[model samples]
Target: MEKNTILEQLRAAKAAHINWVQRAKMLISGFKMEEDAIPVNSTQCKFGQWFYSDAQRLNGLRNNPLDCMSEIEKLHFELHDIYLNIYKIYYDLEPQGFFSKLFGKKKKITDDSVKLAKEYFASMEEVSKKLVNEINLMERRIVALPDTDLETL
Candidate 1:
């Protein structure tokens, strides 16, 4: 694949990851109070799934440029676990009538969920930043390759 093609894919993944992180933060920030407002539901689960999906994509992109992909893949799995944990918590909260039980009519969340979301949010943000930085470095290397070297590929 062309270097730019790979970079573009990485860029798109990073963008999606950032969007999810922002939405998760909103959940913690109380901007989204209704269970429907949260991104963890079936039809609106993009933000929740982005953590796992982006990590996988990042691993594929890194294999061409990084020597130690195993470590990177481990990091991705860690993030995926965190995402799944958040999803699990939300799933449990649903049957309890979380919207009415927590905040009367306001649909407030449990303190525990807030705490977990914050922790995972910080972690996902850090990982996404690191992956984007690595992708940038790889792009620089690709661009600096001599024309003859490019032709050999």
Candidate 2:
């Protein structure tokens, strides 16, 4: 990929993550969204898709001593781990009786769980900030490389 193309993809991935955090905040704020809007798995999100697919092939992001890709992956997983806690708080995922499933019934989420979810959200936000920083650091490394290096990506 050309340097500009790679950079553009990076910007898109960053935006996806930022939008993801915003959507998560919106959910915590009591707005209803499509269930799939905020995926619980780190690897399921758009940013994760891009990071996993493109990071290894990108010149500066892989096979380098100063590579922070692993750190980025760790932080991304931590963010999702925190989100899983919040998701559990908002949903009663235990198996339901056949009748309940047939009727499309769900166990009601409790107010206490809502409060707990907020606490988890705060933790997720912290991890998200670190993830973004690592991504920025990776971007700087990419930009520092000569155009010749970028050409091979």
Candidate 3:
């Protein structure tokens, strides 16, 4: 939890989120990825893992919890919720056991479905921007603190 360490983790988390968004766009573009690769859960993705774990120690950044933390969490969850919609549009390949692959038809990728997924991604980008800004705000606030206080981190 050193100040610079926290800042680096924050930067990595933001990059992780950006990568996830790119994967979603790839899905919409028809290059479907496997489920294990890109997690769709709010609390399971890479950034989510960092947020709930390492970022928890970031709480008492000022003896008062960082307000930006809550905002980032909210936006993070919203971003995943939006991603769920996009996932369903493309990857809802319902498992009907072996027969699903043998007989079940792939869901036709409709123009409308792609359009909708792209729209969801657009929303995610906006949410991601806000999330990044809040993270930057937190970084700035922590950097502004005295090194003695940061040492306590």
The global Cα lDDT (0 to 1) of model 1 is 0.53
- Candidate 2 lDDT (Cα, whole model)? 0.81
Residues 1-153, candidate 2: write the lDDT tens digits: 677887889889999999999998888888875557998888799999998898668635345633688898889999988888877766556877888768866546678877887888899889999999998998888788777777766
Superposed Cα deviation of residue 56, candidate 1 (Å): 10
**For model 2, which pairs clash?**
none
Every model's Cα RMSD, please?
6.3, 2.5, 2.4
Whole-model Cα lDDT of every candidate shown, in order = 0.53, 0.81, 0.81
Q: What number of clashing residue pairs does each candidate have, in the order they appear?
A: 0, 0, 0
State TM-scores per candidate.
0.54, 0.87, 0.87
Worst 10 residues of 1 by lDDT: 42-51
| Model 3 agreement with the true structure over 82-150: per-residue lDDT tens digits | 988887886654665687657754677789989998999899889988988888888788777776676
- List ranges where model 3 is wrong by over 4 Å: 93-105
